[model samples]
Target: MDKFVTRAKKRVGGQSKKDECQRENLQKKPRSEVLKEEFQEDEEVNQFPQPVPWQKIEAEGLDCDYSLLFSKKEADTFFTQLEEEVVYFTGDQTKVQVYGKTYSVPRKQATYGDEGLMYSFSGVHLSARPWTATLEIIRDAVTKATGHTFNFVLINRYKDGHDHMGEHRDDERELDPSCPIASVSLGAARDFVFRHKDARSGQNRRQIDPVKLELAHGSLLLMNSPTNTYWYHSLPTRKKIKSPRINLTFRRIVKQRQRNAIKPS
Candidate 1:
């Protein structure tokens, strides 16, 4: 028992020293460069990204683990900073073929990620734009707090009360399976809803209770795996709130280039 305890203590101490050294090194360099290097994946790296170790919130009757990640002050500042720094565009997503007709998405969005990380959503192929300094800061903060790594971010801007995201799942072929998706909200508060995927089955077909959350400014929400598989989420329009809202959803995409394989007979 003594030997086991001593070994555990030594391991913990070693890990602490390693973390300290890494912190010192990161302090000496620029965040952008550090992020780029991390993407490059050449040296030792931290697996978890949460900086403050945020608390996980468990609401009754909710399927996935949810947490309140940011306060008003932090969210407000980011809203202002990002509005000026990041670019938002509309009509970029390709038209989807539904019911023999093509339709476009309701909101404007921007995608930023490392090279070769392409994302296809709503029949639109979104190529990654190079990472900007502002995004790096936000990405770094998100990763540190949650101990997760993200290669790409989808930025959605709700311009008005009418602008909203309908119920949908994040189960994309290109997405890393079971990976957690981190969302950071800025600007105005909006309604985020989650519904069970079941479309009517259980004898008599009763309605599934919908889960609603107010995604406030400077807030972070994580949609963990199996959550996406079991539930569909949406950002409902709030006609009363006229101000615009920015949502940054960080995700890890499977690199197609890396997935390509050769036949070995």
Candidate 2:
């Protein structure tokens, strides 16, 4: 019996010593300090502003006629200067390859829009040039007429009937969906088609409601809500046209988060 008691006491004493050793080790460790440092580092890394909703504007009963916007002489002069300075392309400037066939885009630019505004696509970024007096005058008139604040304009010079843009949606993640897009067509009037993303049976697979507006030198087309969300629009290629058309798309860009992070040295 004595031997059994002695063995049990030794076992109990061994366990007590092990527990004391663990308690001493935990007391010596700076656990709270370590956790505090980790939390502070996380807070520092995550300190950045979140993106907010973009503003929206709508215009109703606005004049859609081309002749009401500019004179023939002014339109001619603007087109002449644009042709001289704007960069023209024959195929897709981005040159994205897909499905064993490369889709080419023929996009050109003569960017002299607003100050501090920037344009980007794929990975290409374009900074805005200071607005010229002519551009400013045009901008003000268009904004007043449409009731929208357009910050940048992308001028697409379609050289002839052969130059065209293919079927595509303009829903890039960079753009704020709430901000409306305004497109003004000058020169030749072309067909603009809008296709429904979901089509019903017995219906034409694509809706071809054509806007036959002569797009006479200064016509403005504002594309707002529901129209942009449910429809995909494009100006298809036409063979009968002889004159070139200049289409200006006014876009509102959302400020990117990464762009706001750079520290000015």
Per-candidate TM-score against the hidden true structure: 0.71, 0.59
Give residue 40's error in model 1 in angstroms.
19
Q: Which ten residues in a row have the lowest lDDT in candidate 2?
A: 1-10
Model 1 lDDT per residue over 110-143, tens place: 8899997777755556778888866876787677
Q: What digit string (tens of lDDT, one per residue) describes model 2 on residues 184-264? A: 677887887655454323555544333333356755666666555555667788889888898877777666722543224
**lDDT to native, each model:** 0.69, 0.55
Top-lDDT candidate index:
1
Clashing residue pairs in candidate 2 (N, C-alpha, C atoms within 3 angstroms): 91-105, 91-106, 92-104, 92-105
Where is model 2 more than 4 Å wrong at Cα? Answer: 1-68, 87-101, 110-112, 122-129, 200-214, 257-265
